[model samples]
Every structure is written in structure tokens, then in C-alpha cells.
Target chain A: MEHRIESGADALYMDERDHVATALRDMKAGETVQYRNAEGLRAVTVVDDIPFGHKVAVVAVEEGADVRKYGEVIGRAVVSITVGQHVHVHNIEGIRGRGDLGSKEAAAQ
Target chain B: MMNGTFMGYQRANGDIGIRNHLLIIPTVICSNQVCNRIMQMVPGGVAIPHQHGCSQIGADKDRTFDVLAGTGKNPNVGAVIIISLGCEVVDPAALAEEIRKTGKPVEFFDIQSVGGSVKAISHGAELAKRMMADLEKQEKVPVPWNKLKVGVKCGGSDATSGLSSNPALGAAADSLIAEGGSIVIGETTEIIGAEHLLAERCVTPEVSNQLYHIVNRFEDEVQRMGADMRGGNPSPGNIAGGLSTIEEKSLGCISKCGKAPIQGVIEYAENIPDHGLYFMDSPGNDIECVSGMAAGGAHIVCFTTGRGTPTGAAVIPVIKITGNKMTFRNMEDNMDVDVSDMLDGTGSLEQAGDRIWQEIKEVAEGKWTKAEVLGHQEFSINRIGPSL
Candidate 1:
């Protein structure tokens, strides 16, 4: 599987199924960025400045829904995430195989 | 079979070593000072001084013995000089006997038997100097890539780790495995959130069970210690480097193993089996993981770091890779390969992998890694149980 962007795309979607695309370079607010996925090439307008190597949600994710990257569920979004928004620790929670998530789950409820 | 070969020292047991080193081992923490002194006195001598060896019980004591013996037994080590504190739980004679199985020269002495610290250092240094001279005269012979066993590891990870360097390293690992070589991936703690992915790749049901067993066992130990792995993992540096979750970090961590079927699961510091890929139950801590791989008989280790680390081993060489352009530029002295081009769209992952594969060959041909050139011989053995 190839992972390089020959078309000068500013972001990368690891798989067509991945809901989040990682920023290959920093993008200013309102900048339109191109990303390639399994489906085809697509564009998203950055609502927030995305730094290098950080994830930007390519698809809108509802609160408590899984945030998929590399075609796998990395975590669940803590708040409703819109497309082009910066996705990081502030808005997502790690829930996979955790032993101490009861308090976090309770807080979410 | 893999094409091309590098100049190496082929051992009597048929294992090929990239380097011929004189190893000095301390059976107890009490012997660490004397071992270090002896190593210093002898040119080209390396010593691994650890803090365990007395009042250790059961598995802990066995682990120490295994690591020390394994280090002495590594193919890179041409000869060994063992130093004991005269009275420690780890038996130097038995340890030397274990290493002698490889048919390498081994010598042992305890402070009590040798009179005192002064006499012990003098005796150990003399033995080490001779061993070093003997190893210096050993000629390098052509050894195929298939004879190589490399441990794949990542530390100080960030988002680019999974996206670039780790996956590029994975490609390189696959290339080696395709040629009948063996690749080892460890760090059970780092694979916490995404172990199921690896478990699914096991070649057999038994191997899958062992994979799950070790992951579960580590989680159980963490729970017993009244701590959760997610709290400390992904580490602070990882988070600062833009990793938000343990799941995110782990998903990236496993990429360094390439896309190989998990052949078997081995205990920490156990001898790595020949051929294909094996998973060792080891910590994600950089030095401890590298040490386990070296003790497991790895000829070389490929280490990926996003934030940068200058860790090397006492015996084998550690090739450092980074996927962060900034980290690479900032820590140019510490890093070797820069796959950051994958992130910048200047290079493909395959090309980056090929770059690393070339580095491995050159290193096997006697090229020094940045850590080796900088003389960073960091070594640490993973310890279990308490010291009494």
C-alpha cells in the first residue's frame, strides 16, 4: 500500500474508511486542503489551524462515536466533531481496553 | 534467499556477528564498580553494570541470570570476563558455563576468591585486555542478510511515527523477513490498546493465545500495582508530540514490526528463534527493550524515535530513525535515518524503507551508528520483584 502524496496534497487519509485525515503540513484557518483516500481525492476547509502531523476530522463525528484512523477505532469523540476541526486530546477520549474508565464513562453519561 | 552479504565474524556455532566485542559482565550490583573499572582499564572492552543480583527471589533472580548469560552469549561478544562481588545470589560460575555453550572464551573471578577489589580489577583487566586483543585479530567473513536477527522498536513516539518512520521500518522488516531473516518486535505495554490486531495476525492458535496471555498478564500486573497503563503510556512526550491517546500511540507502535505473521511469543531476554518474526514480552522503555533484544541474540536493533533518543546497546548497534523533520534537524547528531520526507510528500515509504535497509547493511559491514560513534553504550535489564 502506498502512503505518499504525489499530487501535493496537504493532508493524508491512511485508508478510504478512515474518518480522520492527518495534516502533512500546517494549515491556517479557512485554508482549503486536499486529501486522498480509498474513495478518491477530496477537499476540506480548515475551521481551525491544524499543525504538522496532527489529525483533522475529514468526516463529521457525533459525540461518543468512534474516531477512526488508519482504518481502526483510535478513540471516541468527547464532543460532536465537525469536518475540518482539529481533533486531539481536548475533544477525544481513549476507551479501548481501559481498566479505569468508569469515572470517565460516568462523566460522559 | 536474500542477495548480497556483509563482512562479519561467523561464530563456531554458525551464528554470524556484525561486531567482535569483548564483554565484561557483573553478576551483582556489588561487582558493578569493579567491572566498570576493569572495562576502563582495558581498551575496546564493554561492560554492562546493572543494579540487581542480591536478595532476588524466583523469577526475578532467573531473569537476571538469563540477561547476564544471554549478553555474554551474544554472537557479537567474542569473549567474556565475569566479575562477582564474592557473595551474591547470581552464580558467576554457572553463568559463565551457560555462555561457554556457544564455545566462546569465558573467564570468571569473584572478589572473595581474588583477595580484594584491587586484585580483582587487576585480574579482570588483564583477562579483558587479552580477550580484546584476540577479538581484534579476528577476520570478518561474508555473511548473508538471512543470517541477521533485528529487533524493531520505537520510543519517544509522535503522530508521524505511525505515519512515516515506523511503517517505513516495517517495510524494511518485511524485506529482511522475505530473505529468510528473523525480525523481533517487543514492548507488550505499548501494544495495550491494539493488541487484538497483532493477536489476529498470529500464525497459530497457540501463538495467538500466548500473545493475549502476555498482554493480559501485563495488564493484570499493572492493575495489581493500583495503576492503569493508559495513565502513563503514550507518555508525556508522546502527548506533547501530538499523540492524544494510548490507542493512537499503540496503533502506531505496532507498525515497526511490518506486516508479518506473529510466529511465536517469547519471554523477556529469551533466545529469539531463527527465521520469520517473533514477539518478545518486553517493556516499551527504550534501553530495557534494546537490552532484551541484544540478550535475545539480535545481531542489530533498529530503533525509531519521533522526539529523539540517543540510546545504544553495550554489544549490538542501535540505528536511530526519526519521522519528524524538526526532531531530525534538531537532533541530527542523535538520529540516523530521516523518513520525514514521507510526511512532506518528498519521498515514498518504500524509498524510506530502502534507505534504512541500506543503513542496516552498511552497519553490518562495520559502519558505526550515531550512538556508537557518540559512545552511548546505554544498558539496562528489566527487573521484576523487589530487592531485599
Candidate 2:
């Protein structure tokens, strides 16, 4: 069972068909986990869920862009998220962008 | 006329229908049981039981009245047998008179006038059977694809729906427009953070302003209730299913209407006129949304979802499609098409669109959708005011 993230998609998608979900739950840094779609061997997906789909939260405030899943922004890290740390509402917040924010046109109406 | 060419009754008001049946229309709640009893004796009859038609004032009452009239005027119905419990604000005879203008036959009886439910049912059954017998005699004609008006709807959406089924359905909606057909997309509340995207697509500034205004009206109502949309619509299951924000949900929601230049915006459940794309202001509740479209004159609805809901309408046929592979696997009984290939890369968006378009054509030609086959005829009119 292989699932690969599609190209042009914004999410750092993790396809979990071949590997165990627990591996993503327990694995630490320096472990090279692979992610594959039908495109056949694109790139390795780091086993992480919360903050970034990359390595777990490591630093105090991450500087990288927030990773998107399901085509919507989930959370943000002021600095880089290192491997194996709980990423919750405290670390990340809703996305702020043009057309990405709550509608203002109707708010006044 | 060519034999076996997708037959539906040719209504007197110059419309064609894929289904030919006499409907039992109840004017008030007091007459629902009597309507049901009449349906027991007639096989090809439908009963629409609603809690409206009394104590409703102003726009609230008018909205209910219009929907009932639209249901009666729907081309699918060959005739209507109205069952009214006397002493209601809604005049059954007046409703029957409005339906008669469509040239479809109508008959009405009041339970109070007939002395009770039993007598009314007996009288209604006779009228219904006679109407059905006449309806059974109406023949189908080869309707031009241009006469086809479809509603594009999405509900129980998750993140994947925008990426898969919704976009794929958008493709199909574009195809329908290309063939000179019309499509209407509704769910005003669901449009939340993305009404501007849709407003930009409107063909005119007035239409765009209408879109903006509908969203505003909905927001005002929410504030009046001392609640925000974030508290409802995008349920907890949607969050767990991979949705992050209502804005995220809305971006996905709008995809069901392909990239056609929107011709106009319409009120909730208002009749769709002419060809091309339209926006209907409505809440995201699936049943009420579907009802709005049906009452607005859509012959069928293309409903896409990732959360796998089993809902259909009493009058319109709902074609269900799914994008989540797990949902497809688990809810095969409810789902009609699978676009999981968008995720797995087995199929292209065009392929999925073509498949759905073919299904729409076949459904228009008398093929029963899974919803209809499974008897999922759900109906709920959006009540704008408190149920006083």
C-alpha cells in the first residue's frame, strides 16, 4: 500500500498506508522516513503530525512558514519546529493572509 | 416521436419531467396523517408534510407558500391532490387554484369539511388514484439538454472535498454550462469567509452586491441569536476529519460551482431562470439546502461530500459522490461515485467529471440514483423565522 502526495498541493502530505501510524507517533529526529504517492518515490515524509509535517518542534520560536493540510492552514511556528515536541494552540495560531482571513465585507454588513 | 427516447410526461405549462406521478400535498400539519393514509392506497403518489401554512406572517408565511406552490408546479408532478385540514390560514382551494394555472390537474379536500381523517383519506385516495391513472397515460419526450437545470451542492465537507470531489464536480458543472444548461449553487452560511470569491464571479455588480448582502443578512441573524457560525455548520467531526477553519471549509464548499461566470444571485429556494450559473442564498443544512434548490426548479442535484452523509430529497434526485477512500470503502451503500483517484492518482479530474456527467445524463433519462433506490427522500424547508 503506497500513498504519495500530489504535486502542486500545499500540504507536506504524509501518506500512511505502507508504514505504521505508531512510527509517526514515536519516531525521533535523524530517522529518515519515506513518503510515496503513485508518482513513485518523490520525497521522504518526516514522521510528524502536529505543527509542521516536517521534523518535530525543536526551537522556542520557529521562523519557517506554516505547513498546510487539506488545503487549509492549520497552525504556525514563529521558529523552526524540531523533532518530537507537542504542537498545540500555544505554539501555533490561525493563518493570516489575503482571502485567507475571516471575511470583512459581511462583518460590516 | 422516436420510441424509447427517455420518456417523461409533457406538462401543460410547457415543461418536461423525468418522473410522472400524482402528489399528495398537505396544506397544514393537521392534514399530514390524512395525506399519509391516502398514499397508503396509491403506489405512485408522494406526500409532502410540512409544519407551516398557519400562524406565519409576512415573508415567513410567503416563503412557505411559494415553496408549496413550486412543489405542486414541479414538472415531475403530473397532478396534485391537495389535502387540507379546514380552518388553516393557508387556503387549500387557493393553492389548488394556483396549481391549476400550470395546467396540471389538481383536486383538494378539507378534513374538517369531510368530517374526519378516515373520510378525507377515502376521498383523497379516489382523487389520487384517478390522477395517477391519468398521469400514467402521459408520455415522455426527448427533452433538449438545454431544458436541464441542475443544482450543485456540497455538505459534510472535509479538507479533501475541495481537492477532489468538489473540484471534480465543478468540472462537471462547467460541462453542463457548456452544453447550454443551467446550474445553481447555494448554502449562504457556508460561504462565510469566501463570499467575496463568489461575488467576483458574478456577471454583474448587482449580482455581486446581492451575494455580499445575503452573507451580511445571514451574519446579522447569527449575531441576533448571540452565536457565531464557528459554533455551528463546521461541526467537530469536520475538524477531526481534517478541516482547520470555516474559511478552509468554505474554500472547499465553493468549488462545486465550476469556474463559470456567475450570471446572478438568487434568494433561498427562489426559482432559477434562464441558463448559465447562479448562486442561491441558503443555509448549509443539507436537507434545507436541497429543498431550496428543488423548490427553485432544479430537476436534480449533484451532491459531493467527504464525510459520507445519506440524505436525499422528497422531490429531487440527489447524486452522491465521495472523495475520501476510507469513506468510500466504509459507506459504499450510500456513495455513488469515488474520486479518490484524485488523491491516489489513478484517474484524472476530467475522467471523474465525465463519469459524473454520464451519470447525470442517465439519471435524467430515468435511471434511479442510489438515493432514490434506497428511498432517501429527505425534505426540510428552511424556516427563516422562529416557529411561532
Candidate 3:
């Protein structure tokens, strides 16, 4: 994926396939932030107040669908997420190293 | 620009050391007070007082013994004085013998045979003063970059760690590797979902399989206890800093090692080879991981943190780099490098990488890291088995 190092962007999205953009600063609800991705620069209006260094969804995600970051799957969406919503543990759950799920779904498998 | 060389003390066994430290080691918990007292009485003396030395069996005892011997053998230490209680499971004589193989001055005695802590402290102090005087006579010679071995680690991570500091440190790691220096990356428990990426980068199938084996071993142990790594992996601070999953954290964590192909996978506290990149199997606990790296012979450590930590090692310098502007500003005394500008668009990734690389070069050439200046000589050993 193309990575351009330009100035003055509000959020940063690492890959073109990523559904979320990390807020570079504390962002309030309804504020549109610009970011650069493989497809070129784009803007998204945040629906939730996202804190600095937090993730904000750039596209709508269906529950149980994989969420991508750094061009790889980071976790699975636990709940349907709308564009510009804060994407974090509240909405996403990790699928690896879940020994609490019992031996059937142990991390080794 | 400075030349790619640093002034280093040349040891008797031909190993180059950046620091000429007089180390005092306690063979058992019973001798800790005496060692500490001796360290206090003598100038330029460092003491390591640990909890393990007795009641450990088999592999556990072996690990403790290896770490103690390895620490004493580190090129950073010029002379070693080992104090034992004489009743501990760990053998002080053997430990001193292993260190003496380096051809450095090694002295060992028992508090029991020396007639208790008071006399032991006085005797140890006298030996340490004499050793320190001799170490002062040693002169540093010009050493090439290839003589350096650095350990890359990340802790108290935040989302910014992945976005900035980690990748920046990765660039520094790559630069060091390009210069024929060595880099070792550990924290097997943190590399859960990202093991495949690292495994694919292994130089051979054997190394790749070993990477998978270590990951599976950690997972099996977690499964045996019916405990989920999630309950502790991202940790409360990590979650508050916006890291949601171990997969995300691991991806960022691995980036600190750069893109060097894995040469081999070694056990925790095992001696790191003289050159290239190696992966050591170690836990994610900050102190234990750093200590393991020190025992493995890392001359220095480049640590990236977003939430910030003041952790340092007893035998190595830990250079702290952070990706959060606020964190760096708030903890400037502890942080050595700030690469947070990558997030705000004020700096490019390459520029941030260069910044870290420059810091590493300077630190290698006798510059003190913030952790060292603050006297944070934290040490801990990773245990594999229960104490008997």
C-alpha cells in the first residue's frame, strides 16, 4: 500500500483495507477529520468523541466481521459499528490466545 | 556526523565492553544484606540482590545459576565478587569459575565461612575497592559498530507506539543490523497473533518451527491453567491507551525489531550470538524480559513506550523512546527520545527513525540514558518451574 508522509492530517489510516482511522488528536463528535490512505486522501465525520490515540471507524462494520489494522486482522467486531464511531474493546474482541474459551478454542489451535 | 566507532574497554577474552563495572553478586537471599553493604561501602560497586538461590529444583535452579553466571560474564562487568551463604542450592564456586573463564578477576567467598555478614561485608568491601582501582587503570580503545549487541523491547504500550516509536526503533534496529551489529527481540507471550509474520521471516524452516513451538508452548501453559491471556495481555493501562487486543499490540511490538530476518530462536537468558538478529523466548513482564536480555549479553537496550516506564537493567543501559507527545513532555526526565511528532505530521517516519538511530549511536559512545541517570537498576528473573 502507498504511504505518503504529508502534514496536517487529522487522523492516520495505515492501509487501504483498514476500516478505522486512529485519531491523532482528541476529536469531538460531528467533527470531520482528514486522513491519507492507499486510495488517496479522504474525510470522515466522527459520530463519537474519540480521544487522542484512539481508533475511529471509517466504514460501517457488521458484527463478527474482521477488523483490519496495519493491513492485517487485529480483532473481530463484537457489535455492529457505524462510520465515525469509536472502535475499541467496547466494540471489538480479540480472537487469539483465548484459553478462557476452554481447550476447544485454545490459542494453540 | 560522528564516525561509526565508539570507545570501549577491551576485555581479556577479547570482548569489548562499553561499561567497566565492578559487580557484587549475592548467591542466596541470606547474603543479600552483606552484598548490599559492601556495595554501599565501596565506590563504583554495583550489587544484585535477588530472591532466587535456594529451594529451586532442576531446570529452575539451572536457570537461576545460568543467569547469575551470565550476568557476571557480561562484557559490561570488569570484575565480580560473589558472596554466598554457603548453604544455598546454587554453587558460588561454580558461578565464579564460569565468570573467570572470561579471564576477568573473580573473587568468591561465603558469609558463613567469613564469620557472618559484618566480617563478610568488610572483606568484600576491601576486595571491591582493590578491583575498582585496577578497573580504573584499564583504558578504552576504539571499537567498531560490529562489536555492539542491542536488545529491542516495548512496554507500557499505547496506540501511538505502533504508529511512531516502535517503527522508529525498528529503523534503528535495521541500521544496527546493516552495520553487522546484533539485535535480539524477546517477549514470546506478546507475539500471539503475529508469530506467523515473524516465523515467515525466519532464515530457515528450522528457525520458523522453533518460533511456532515457543508460541505454542506458552499457549499450552496458559490453557493448562484455564486462564485467558486477554485478562492480562493488553493490560489495563494498554486498554486505557487505546490498545484493544493482543494481536494489535503484538503487531506493534514486533515492529521495534525492524525487518531483519530471524537468524535463530534462543531460550531465555541464553547467550546471544555475536552478530545478526535473534529471537529469545521470554515472558512479557518488563523487568524479567530486560534482565533476561542483560544475562544474554545485550550491551544496550532500546525500549519504546507510549504510556511511559522508568524500568532499567542492572547491567545494561535502557534508552527510553516514546510516541506520545504528552507522555514525553510529562515524563521528560525518564524519556530519552521523543518520536511523537510522527503522529502530528510534524515529522516523517524516516526522520523519527534517524532520531532514534542517532540516540543509539550517542548512547553507545558513553552518553547516559535517562534510566541510568535516574539510577533505575531494576532486575528480575523469569521462572519456568515452581520452587521445591
Candidate 4:
């Protein structure tokens, strides 16, 4: 997917499949930020303050659903996330390299 | 724009060196002081004082010896002086002999043989002075890009790392490979979740299997400890910078190597091939990883970071590039290049990549990186087992 540069974009999404866009600057709650994705320039009014270098959901995600970034699964959503809400450890859980989960799977097997 | 050729020192073993270093190696931790003393006495002398070399057995001992010997044999080093503290698991003679095979001058002795630390320091200082004199006389000639081997690495990463600096460095890596040069990517732990992506890019089935093997081995080791890699991996700092999972971090981390097809996988500190892109099995710890690359014969390392790191190697130059503008503005003394403008829609990826490519050429031709100028000679070796 192409990342076309749109002047004055407040955030950037790497691929068309990415569910979240990364904040280019600290954004306030209830603020509308513009970002460029494969679909071109789009706007999202954030429900939560997003810090610079942090991720903000560009599309809504249901709990336990895979979150894609760079056109790959980054993690699974731990809670239902709304569009424009902050997306990070608070709302998502990493599924790989979880030795805590590996032992549990071993016991179940 | 500068030409494609870089002015570099021609080594006796047909290797090209960007820096002609007079390297002083301490064969054992016990000899660190003497080695450091000699470094102080002899101008232009660089010493690597590491913790291993004593009470290590089997592969562990061999790894320490290999890393030390490899660092000495690095083309960047013009000559070497090895100091040992009489009795250590690492044999000083064998270490010197290994480096001598490179056709470079090597001198070695033990503190016991030279009376003590004071006498050894004096003797080592004398030897280093003479070697430094000879190294100063070597001339640098025009060398093509194919003669260089560059290592791409990322540490203290944040969200912007994958988006900007890392991929930009990847472009630079690809540019070097296009010139028939070599690029080595490591930090096997960081690539755990993203190994499958890299595997698909391997040139052969065997190379892909090796990639998976290393990833599986690391995961099994982590599982053996019954501990999660979360807190340790998407490190507290990484989390603070918005990297939530190892998968996300790994995906971002691998982008620094560009899109080159993987040619082969080599053990840590093993000699990197003369050309093509290779992967070295190594740890994610900043100093240990960079040290391994240096030992593997990397002439220079291009390190990308979101949170700034002041890591450098004993004999090789580390070019620090950052994607976080604040981190760059705050740590300007430690940072060499800033590509954060790409995140702000102010700079294109090609411009960022070209900026790094220009920096690589400049550093290759004798320009000092901020790490080198600030004297950040950080080095560490990855161990397989406990010290005996």
C-alpha cells in the first residue's frame, strides 16, 4: 500500500489494512485529526488524547480481533475499541512470545 | 555529490579498513587494567576490556576467545597487542595466533611472564607505541563500495522507528547491496514474531529454515524460564514510546534491513560474507549486538533509534539515526542523523534514505560519527553459559 503525503496531516497510516494511525503530534481529546491512508485524506475525531508517536484507531475493532499494522497482525484487541480512540497496551494484547500463555496451552494439551 | 569510491586503508589480508586502529586486547578480565593503562600510554591505541575470558568452559570459553580474536582481526584494526594475567581459561598465545592468521602484526605476553601488572603495563605500552608508529604510516587509497560491509540495527525503538528511520535505513541498506556491498542484520530475539516475514524473503529453503530455527530456539529458551518476554522485550521504554508487542516491534525492527533477500544465516561473531545480505544470530541487547557485528567484520554500523542511545564499538564507527524529532533535538550530541521530518509530512522517504546514504559515504571516507567523536566505545559479548 502506498503512503501518500498529505500536507498538514496530523497522523499517518502505513497500509490500507492498518486499523490504527500513528499520531505525528500530541492530539487533544475531542479533536479532529487528518490522516492519509491508501484511500487518501480522511478525518477522525479522537475520543481520547493521543500522544505523539502513539497509535489512534482509524477503524472500530471488536474485542479479540486482530489489529493490523504494516499489513500484518500486531496484536489482538483486548477490549472493544471505537474509531479515534487511543490504541495501545491498554486496549490490545500481544499474542506471540507469551510464555505465560504457552505453559497454559501445554497443560491443556 | 561525492563519488562512489571511499578512501580506505588497504590491509595485508586484502581487506579494506576505514579506520587504522592500534587495538589492545585483554585476554582475561584480570588484565583489563594493564590493557587500559597501555591505551593511555600509547597515543592512537584502542583497548577492549571485556568481562569474560576467565573460568569459561566449552562453547562459552570458545565464544569469548572467538569474539576477542575476531575483533583483533577486524579489517579496521591495523595491529593488535594481547595482554593476559598469567592464568586464564583463554589462552593468550592461541588468541594472538588466531589474529596473526589475518596477516596483521600481533604481540602478546602474560603478566606473570613480565613480572606483574606494573611491568606488563610498561612492556605493553612500549609494544603499542611501536605499533602505533607503524599504523600511522599506512596510507588510504580509493576503494569501491563493494569492499564495504555494513550492519543495520535498531535499538530503543518507538512507533515512528518503523515508519521513518528504520525503513529509511533499509533503503540505504538496499542501496549498498545494489552496489555489490554486504549488509548484516541481527538481534534474533527482536525478530521473533516477524521471522516468518523475513523467512519468505530468504533466497533458499535452507536459509528460511535457519531463520525459523533461530526464532524457535529463542522462544523455547524463553519458555524454559517460564517467564514472559513482554516486560523485557517491548521494554518499558519501548512501551512508553508506543510499541505494545514484540510482534509490532519486530515488524518495525526488520524494516531497517530494507527489502534485500536473505542470502545466509551465520552464528554470532562469525565472519560475515564478503557480499550480499546476511543475518547473524545475536541478542537484542544494544552493546552485545553491536559488539557481535563488529567482531563479524562489519566495517561500519548504521543504528536506528527512536529513543536516543550512545552506543559505539571499539574499532568500528556507529552512525546513529533517530526518528523522534524531540529525541533528536534533545540528544543532538549523540545523534548523527534525524529523519523525523518524514513523520511530519515535511520530507519524503526517498529524501530521508538519501540523507542516510550520504552519511554512510561520508563516514566511510573518514568522517567521524558522533559516537566516535564522543568516545562511546561500548562493547559486550553474548554468552551461552555461565562462567565456570
Query: Top DockQ: which candidate number?
Result: 3
Compose the digit string of candidate 4's lDDT tens values, residues B306-371: 988888899999999998999999999999999988877778888888899889989998999999
Per-residue error for B313 in candidate 4, Å, reads 0.9
lDDT of 1 by residue, B1-388 (tens): 5555778898988888998889999999898899989888887899899988899999999998999999998999999999998789999889999999999999998998898899999888888877888888889988877888999999989888988899999999998898888999999988877899999999999999999899878866765555445547878788777788877888898989999899999999999988899999998888999999999999899999989988889999999999999999999999999998887778998999999988987898899999999988888989988988
- Each candidate's fnat, listed in order, reads 0.41, 0.04, 0.62, 0.60
Error of 4 at B379 (Å): 0.7
In candidate 1, the residue pairs with backbone N, CA or C atoms under 3 Å apart (3 or more residues apart, or in different chains) clash, namely: A16-A38
The full ranking of all candidates by DockQ, starting with the best, is 3, 4, 1, 2
Model 1 TM-score is 0.95
Worst 10 residues of 1 chain B by lDDT: B222-231
**How does residue B149 of candidate 1 score in lDDT?**
95
What would the TM-scores of all predictions be?
Answer: 0.95, 0.84, 0.97, 0.97
DockQ-based CAPRI category assigned to the predicted complex of candidate 4 = medium
- Residues B1-388, model 2: lDDT tens digits: 1232355556677777777757788888889889888887998788888788887777887787778888888777788998888988788888889878889888888998898988888889888888888777767776667667899988777656776798889988998888877899998877776777888888889988888888878766665554434436567666555555565577678888899999988887788876799988888888888888887878899999888889987777899998788788998888888887776567778888878888888888888888888977677767876666
lDDT of 3 by residue, B266-285 (tens): 99999999778999999999
Top lDDT model? 4
Task: Give the per-residue lDDT digits (tens) of candidate 1, residues A1-109.
Answer: 7656565688878876777888888889899999986667789999998888788989999999989888888889989999999999889877744555434344234
- Deviation in Å, model 3, residue A78 alpha carbon: 1.6
The fraction of reference A/B contacts recovered in model 1 reads 0.41
Where does candidate 3 clash, by residue pair?
none
| DockQ for candidate 3, C-alpha atoms | 0.60
Which CAPRI category fits model 3?
medium
Least well predicted 10-residue stretch by lDDT in candidate 4 chain B:
B1-10
Rank candidates, lDDT, best first.
Answer: 4, 3, 1, 2
Query: What i-RMS does every model get?
Result: 3.2, 8.0, 2.2, 2.2
